[model samples]
Target: MAVRSTHSPSKIPTIYQCDSKGRENQTIAADMHGTLLIDRSLFPYFALIAFDVGGILRLLLLLLTAPLAWFLHHFVSESAGIRVLVFASFAGVKVSEIESAANAVLPKHYSEDLHPETWRVLSSCGRKCVLTESPRIMVEPFLKNYLGVDLVLGTEISSWWGVATGFMARGGVLVGEQKAMALRKAFESSLAPEIGIGDSEADFAFMNLCKEKYIVPSEQRVRPVKQVELPKPVIFHDGRLVQKPSPLIALLIIVWFPIGVLLSVSRVLIGSNSPISLFYYIIQLTGCKILVKGTPPPNAKNSRRTGVAFICSHKTVMDPLFVSAVLGRNTTCISYSVSRLTEFLSPIRNCRLTRERSKDAKIIKDILEEGWDLVMCPEGTTCREPYLLRFSSLFAELTDEIVPVAINIRTSMFHGSTARGRKWLDIFFFFMNPLPVYEITFLDKLSPDQTCSAGKSSFDVANNVQEMIGTVLKFKCTKFTRKDKYRMLAGTDGLVGGKPGAVAADKLS
Candidate 1:
């Protein structure tokens, strides 16, 4: 007869039986899902528990050593495969999770430093490819999705049992000579790249295979080299302006409300022009360096030195103030719009006008006839990039003695454009910097005939002047208008619903 053990149903073991000696024993086994199923056997139970504990300890060790491995790979070995391995060791089921997180933010960081001109060229190229030594797992998505590259070549990382084992693919490393070999094998067809561009010496081997080679200097290893040549009338200096101010300068600006008011009152009482000079002094106190290129032309015979009709590239609100300071004369500015506080606080006279061509022309002509020197930004808005938008020619029709001026503003900490904020905020941020430099170049005097002809309208005059200024300053000429910019920033075309009729007239001309 067979011996059987009786026990409560809840106490039954999944794997337990009585041996020939009638002694109860148990064994270890696995379920269909590969989960370890153990009976009440002491030795096997302890062994399985120890194995799990060892796995946990090994995972913890990898987590602790990850940073050390990354540091060694970056500083000592400089090996791309080692870097990949370091990242791979930490990756388990989280590879997709890591990729999803990187996808959300990495494109923005990559594009911050990418030049617009570079992007234009790359997008226009029919067959574009990215060759990098970084692991394909990291770079491919960005190159393919964001940049729309046709092909990508990068280091390969291996995975095992649904987890990365910190091992590189069979090839030793994808760099230097290896990169060159890979490029040759991949592009075996007769058609090859017409031009090749690279940043470091490591890229030279493969770049040499192309018909033309251009090397982009690495920021870490190479000094920036400026290639564009500005015209004779233009002067270019690259430096930071907004910086920590000296104690004395800072104190003066802080106490400027009292001092400035006193200076204004004294100038008024004495009938002196010292107030204008003092205003300029305050601006210069901010460590701003102003460069003036051309001289003011002599007056015509009958003209009572009719104030110069200054047409400038709009950069910041301080433009009129700085130009007046540079010229050592009070200038009346014509603006489309201005804040109530700014208009009230401004020392110089500001004339506001509407977009209606006839109305604006009448106001501008009256101001000129009054012998008040007029300063205007023909672009109708401020642009921070090294580019110029289409100019409004209404000012061109008002005066023949138009002085084309190019203004370049450089700041280390803040950009002096109103695109990101309001005018007052732009000024606040600008002055907050330690130093801000302003470069104002007065180009040749532009006459109506020089810019306008029988078939050509005042718009021609505006474009001619724009070309002269852009050429001198090495700025790209663009068709973008203030309306387009406003639409981009504020999500509306203008104060009105659509583009202004004045801008439409300018475009037609």
Candidate 2:
């Protein structure tokens, strides 16, 4: 594969290849100005915050403070012509309420998604604030405590004698141009040269107000903003989606299928102890493969005793079965579906064939209590890139340790994941032709830590795990931002289709 560099005057490089650190620099350069662009001193001191209040309960209280402040300012400022004092008192009270809410929402895992650089910049800056539409009540705690921001200017809601009153400024809306204006007004006299970071185009409106406008790159590509054309989104292809398979690959899958069956038979007939042998067998049979990159956790030597969630990269449908063979009876796999055609009750009967509204919590709870090593693909489904999907937070509750696993299926046999519009017949035809060896790569395991509060939302835990995994994997497999999906459909023009060397480079990178 040839690497394309240096765009000529006639043609622009449609895409850019950069890792996380490079992406960060790109965002800052595109949005910021002044000598501080290259200044290392400000890098650590740039505080970052978001728009949300974090959770349901706190969001409610934050919503309440809007009207509460509005009423006070409405009366006091009108009566005394000293509105700053009224707003200041209201801001303080609202800030305290936010602190209380943060305490209530205590024990959240640190997330790289939802404003990670913001936190990094804030922690580095030593001072930060949350600029959200959430009332000052919700924004204050995070701004003052977690982010350590000096100020929070947000909407206010009202409460009457502890119960919220339904009155607020313009009925409590602080979004769009208003949010941008509010932020600009607060920082008007600052000489420190502040840098602002945001995730969306909406954020660009406000971000432009700052000395710099830092736009977070989506999973696939950066997009064209109002005036600035951001970098193209990054496309992460799963190893399983290759187009043609080599001859040796065909032989491997054929040999592995029966071996898996034999292991399953022996486990039942001869009382053999190892179930993972069968799992390996099944994966090989399913036309997929596993590449164990690191040492299996000593604690996970027997998954039955440990609450292990085999958090594998999602690609093909064969993943759950492949992992099941490896784990054997020591674990139970949870999937979105199962075959109605197959009978014979195994411990695998616990599988849910569909995602229903009510069953999720119950299923996750039972699996944890049984001390079973639950196998889950955080992506929930296969996409063009396995790395971009948001991981499920269920692992945070089930186990403290997450075994980071990566799988690369040679897609040469298949057109691509239906996620990219390849049909079932297309996949089957590819299998009928030549096949490629499936490569499963397992990375390091994260030791379980109870750093996040148990009471926090599962999504929060998943977000934390995604970040941790992203840093370790370094291939950007964490959150699938909206931009990521859009880029996959767009495809890379002039790029070779299914070139082995080119695909391999993508995997390693």
Candidate 3:
């Protein structure tokens, strides 16, 4: 077997020469910033955390310090500039808030930026570690969960009384020689890691420490690793920013905030109050694009004596609203522990559910018997990925007239949903985009033979509806429930308000 060497009295070879084959037994240290990630810029990630965790005030604070940070980065030192950014973005923010953004938000953004050729080499190693100038808390979750990294060597953020002080600990930013030292300490000896991967001049010191090294070509014209190519699929991510906020995009958001607020409010009021026949056309004038596919079953009020149960693939708090809007009439919506403000701002009448199975069943049955069509997301919570969470059987048992609805949303600037932040803002952020789109697919309604009353089990009917919606949306159906989502994103059991009865509304199905 032959080994590739950087010190062979010849020009160092690119990562392409580092042969990923048979490297599964090797340990490697890979850089996170410019090396593994396609874009070398750090401002956007800092901005994402700042805006998501601290809101506009924190974001503004970060922006004000940008000039000084840029100066220090170019003239003084990259570490000094990064230090200022750390303080501006995270100082005084609650540790829990930062952690939530890390767990729920950063992974999707990080996964979208993987450097294809670089990832080819990094993913082959048996043991992997990441070295970067960013805070470890910010990258740890994503690196470990998505990329199979065993260790993350990065700057450490200090905390006090459960809040971040924004000051970094002892060794400061993990750049230049500092990064090399951390790698050495983690491996416990020199020459322990068999390979090193990096892209910038700042990474040279650390790359020299490994037994062998490979440089990721900065000017190489290679496409980024696509989502389908990632080591693990990013099925769940939570954040209000639909697009990654670069310097220019961040500025636009700051300027667009007030204008978007007014537009969103006006759109909501008009969409809710407009006549059913004109709801689709009227909402588009306010920057909303709605595309309805497949024929929706006629309104139960006119076509049948009993109301219909419309089950949906949850995308946002606005799912029920659009279902009924697309139908041009109000559909009764039931939510579990939905915020009062969301219900108040919404035009669709909402029914709250008590987890007591019998009580919930009665409420649903009574509503259907009244000949009022009802819409609910069987998955319970909004999922951003192209996968459906387990459908709740409760909705299946309540009615024989079951209809499955598939809903998908597209936003250019911000997501309208969150697991750890303000829940009421889901709808507001949704409408804040310049051209938000809603694609609603109404699948064929189930026949009486498929209903729970016809000897089919409740779970069977629930799953049947789930498969139908997933098929049209090109999504995979899963057995994971809303509890699985909350446990990962919010560190809860899909409950809110600290009460057992406060589980998220998806349980209302």
Model 3 reaches what TM-score against the true structure? Answer: 0.91
Q: lDDT, candidate 2, residue 423?
A: 34
Two-way TM-score contest, 2 vs 3, winner: 3
Q: What is the lDDT of candidate 1?
A: 0.52
Please give, for residues 1-509, the per-residue lDDT of candidate 1 as tens digits. 11122233333222112111311221110110000101111111111111122222333343344456457655765464245433433344344532432332223223323433233334445566666555565545545554556677666666776455455676645666566666667677645454444544555566556544444432332211122311011011111112222223323334443444354344332322346656656556445566778885543323665556888988877688777777776778889877675666567788899889899889888887777878899888876656778888887676777888888877654445544334554454455444567788888786445744434578778888888888888887766677665543332322355534222212222
Inter-residue clash pairs, candidate 3: 240-415, 242-414, 336-505, 380-506, 395-509
- Candidate 2 lDDT over residue span 307-376, tens digit each: 6666776665545544555444446667764334221223343466345544775776666666666777
TM-score of each: 0.49, 0.38, 0.91
Give RMSD to native, each candidate: 22.7, 21.3, 4.5
Task: Report the number of the highest-lDDT candidate.
Answer: 3
Instruction: Quote the positional error of residue 35 for candidate 1 in Å.
Output: 41
lDDT of 1 at 295: 83
Candidate that would win on TM-score:
3
The ten-residue window of minimal lDDT in model 2 covers 42-51
Clash counts per candidate, in order, are 10, 49, 5
Candidate number that wins on TM-score, 1 or 3? 3
Give a tens-digit lDDT track for model 3, residues 99-190.
88988889989998899888888889898989999999899889987788998999998899989998998888888889878887887643
